[model samples]
Target: MTYKANLTQYLSNEFKRLYEEPFNTDVTVQVGEEGHSKIFQAH
Candidate 1:
């Protein structure tokens, strides 16, 4: 297979694994103005 195809396959498998068994962690993202921004999280 081509390099691009192999890379795509690898990414696909990684996403599948992540969806099937995700990490038990929290992530926070703040968008917009620093103080006025909102925080988003996935627990």
Candidate 2:
């Protein structure tokens, strides 16, 4: 598996854990080089 694949799986699991459903919504995210930073904005 590549880095992208692992990240995708992790994000999917997290979405399900937090929302109790699959991550099926359209979304965008900004990640910093530190790898632990996430920024979300509503437009």
Write down the RMSD of all candidates, one decimal each: 7.3, 10.3
Q: Which stretches of candidate 1 lie over 4 Å from their true place?
A: 23-43
lDDT of 2 by residue, 1-43 (tens): 9999999999999876765422223433333334322222222
**Could you tell me the TM-score of candidate 2?**
0.47
Model number with the top lDDT: 1
Q: Against the true structure, what is each candidate's TM-score?
A: 0.46, 0.47
RMSD of 1: 7.3
What candidate 2 gets wrong by more than 4 Å, as runs, is 21-43
lDDT of 1 by residue, 1-43 (tens): 9999999999999986775343332322323444423222233
Candidate 2: C-alpha lDDT = 0.51
